[model samples]
Target: MKMVIVDKANEGKKLFRYIRTLAPSMKNGEIFMSIRKGKIKINNRIEDQGYILKNGDVVKIFFPDEIIKKYTDNDRNKYRSIDSNIDVIFEDKDIIVVNKPAGILVHPDRREFKKNLVESVKAYLYKKNEFKPGDYFTPSPCHRLDTNTSGLIIFAKTHFALQKISTLFRERNGDKLYLALVFGKISSSILISSSIDASENKENKVAVKEAHIHNFIPEKSKFIEENPTLSATYVRPLKYDSRLSLVEINLWTGKKHQIRASLAAALHPLIGERKYYTSQSLSLSQMLNVSNYYLHCYKLKINGYEEFKAPIPKKFSQILSEMFKIDAAKL
Candidate 1:
């Protein structure tokens, strides 16, 4: 039998949700069945899956230790050598905001074995004695940025903070601003309200339909009806040259590849973007010998929270100066 005590980090989480995090190897059906069969109990009482966990509650799972250990999070052991040099923008008791450089994955996948942002954050917190190994709830990012997109990403230090921040993001109760250098010149501000089809995604790239003048309309087409998502991007041209435009993007919908695909649909693909760009933009990117995309999440503000901004990366700033003759610091 394995037992877990509800802590502040896991407080307010549903029983089923808490179980999935504790025993990750167990399938959903198995968890439901185990709960139904009285194999799981909270405070020595059988509770439904939807029961909200509270601090000091004791959860018991009548499963073998070996089975529970086999599927639990073992990332701490996997990453012995931790990189603690994280660029922290703002940190408080509840949350930490860091600037993620381009070329690092936020979360590790099967193909990624090296240290990622999560590991780095954990290592940093561990060094400060704020986090401990074998803790059921580890600090995690509230949202994700693309691997090549450099900028501010927030991590929740507590479970209560995670729940609150996640709700803010889900309800779009905050503003996220991105800065980019797109290929074509944008004369004025443009609002691109388009629907993205993930079902049609190929090679890790999603398809964005033509922008509509009105608000997003649900996908009625049979081909992409299964996984269509609404997206809106407000592009304000900050500065422009003959070939490229420095633009500030106000993202209304945080869908996958929303900024890249939406700009491509508007004929103003971001410089250095590998996917969702015209052939001419690709040629220009090749000529410039760019290593990563030029999109950066520059600013973020949650409702009733202090606004946070990440300074532009040195390379990103240098590139802008060399290409457009505009100093990024001034903007």
Candidate 2:
């Protein structure tokens, strides 16, 4: 199996409820039976029928590794679509950098999310007989992007690279870039140093001062955030049409939604944001049918390796040219 951590948001829920969150396809009764069979354990120890779960508790799932692997392979083939548009910026013995498109899962989420970039990458590599650890079974993405945020995501080829790249991202040494179409105009790049607070009630709120995050979401492997860190980004106006302006941004910190949150805080929320709504300007939210925002991870620089830059994906640049008659190539 797999391991699940009860996040702070799931604190008050019952153990069975928490189990349901782990695998929605399985019922509570089924989970109960599994627990009885010694398959489910709480905090790395076996759980009885009465075992209670709370926030930050580790839930270990012990089943045959082969079975879990099979489940992943089957689901990848069955659920997520195959996209030929996945752009590879660079690949070496240690790492791979790729341009992820919008409207796809970077990984599977049980919340009715579609299959994503990692699976597509695996399939591509497998088809080319390129699967390996130092050589078969490279690690999954050491980091992630938001479901609606299109950008560059890095994958590690070996355990050593995974560790090094992981540390680099944690130290905020990597360069992250995004291009966005927002509703209004700004004289220059505006960086908002806001603090994000998450309550036990699972609500996330923003504070102007630095706020420390007591992570309740216990990820198997975690990426760390330095609270009140120097989160900087450079934004330059690419072009402006009647209403929206296309801006390119490079972030200094890898906070959860750094670019999105900061931009929205500056009254330039993403052009098609539905969750983080902005009222100061018009967004594509009221416009034609679409499922994603207009931000693209145009480039990523990890550990000063700026050997190449990922060009803006077609959907993002094309939207600018088509909707506003502004070409994004000049950026």
Candidate 3:
């Protein structure tokens, strides 16, 4: 909703400081720049952009819905129902593992996710397994990948597995292994740490800077307010094919997009990563056509037992055989 502020409400505070009380999500510096950028208006008049608010002064805070709106209603409910084609990987009494293809969402962002993995999994299990209508099938992905990313995913079939798995991640007992193809050759083991920023463009969000914390021009790097996440990764390079390499990465933390962001920050961006460029990498966008991301959860071990892996995805499978010349079918 557009905001109209009461006069004298802020007691003659600076324009940006006053606005912070109204829109707390915006940083003071950001609000100040928005005021300078002519984004803030006063009583429908573009007053001296620097005008401070006095008692009885009306302040119009312009929060463009475009900035507020990241997802649309029609788009939100698009993937509510899980498709029946989800590959059932492995199942025990406590959990179910499914092969999630890239591009399918793990859950509905709103009611309208076009292809929700959880809902689809629910519908499939109910219809095929004689699960009673509204039977309590708790839908929770033990871990997640980017919606555009595909591969093995685990769902807690029972609450016990969910709690155990969740705690496992918290205690760092369970870890995920991702198989990825990237544009450059990374020879030795390296630890990559990056402070990611969700910068926006006209179309979508862009993640920039590889710093421990992202600081833009003029903004000093603010110490990350959130707890500094601990991360460790073990990289095993299987084969190098001049332009790309087939590698397996074991993640030490479950941070959001850790592999993609960390690798990009290290100049070995994922082959198909369209963001966070290091200026020395190749663009895999043109070559990537698979539904999910080029990254795959190729292997998983909880409490140190590795049994589930759905062979390499097709796009990379062919690339693997042709580039490394290993018949993936034989693996």
Q: Give me the candidate number with maximum lDDT.
A: 1
Ten-residue stretch with the least lDDT total in model 1: 215-224
lDDT scores of the candidates, listed in order: 0.81, 0.63, 0.62
| Local distance difference test, candidate 1 | 0.81
> Per-residue lDDT for 171-271 in model 2, tens only?
76776667787777654544444554323233353333352222232221232343344444456666765567778776655566666666666666777
Better of 1 and 3 by TM-score: 1
Error of 1 at 11 (Å): 4.4
lDDT of 1 by residue, 1-331 (tens): 9887898778788999888666544679999999988899999899899999999999999988876676554544443467879999999988999999988899967674865898799889877878755456678899979888999999998887888898898776877899998997776877787778776534888877767542333332331244246577778888887888989998776788888988888888888888888998998888989756888999999986889998998998999888778777776
After superposing candidate 2 on the true structure, give the runs of residues whose Cα lies further than 4 Å from its correct spot.
Answer: 1-85, 132-138, 198-231, 282-291, 322-325
The TM-score of predicted model 2 comes to 0.63
Estimate the TM-score of every prediction: 0.81, 0.63, 0.63
| Worst-scoring 10-residue span by lDDT in model 2 | 211-220
- Stretches of model 3 off by over 4 angstroms after superposition: 1-82, 111-113, 194-228, 279-293, 304-306
Per-residue alpha-carbon lDDT of model 3 for 1-331, expressed as tens digits? 3565544324445665555434434556777777777677776666654576666666665656765332222222333333567788887666778888887888867666376787676656555663322222334688777787888888876545666787887666776778887767765544444545546567454353543422121111222123254333456677785666777887765666677777776666777666544444544545445223378887777884566777777876886776678776554
Error of 2 at 121 (Å): 1.6
**TM-score attained by model 1:** 0.81
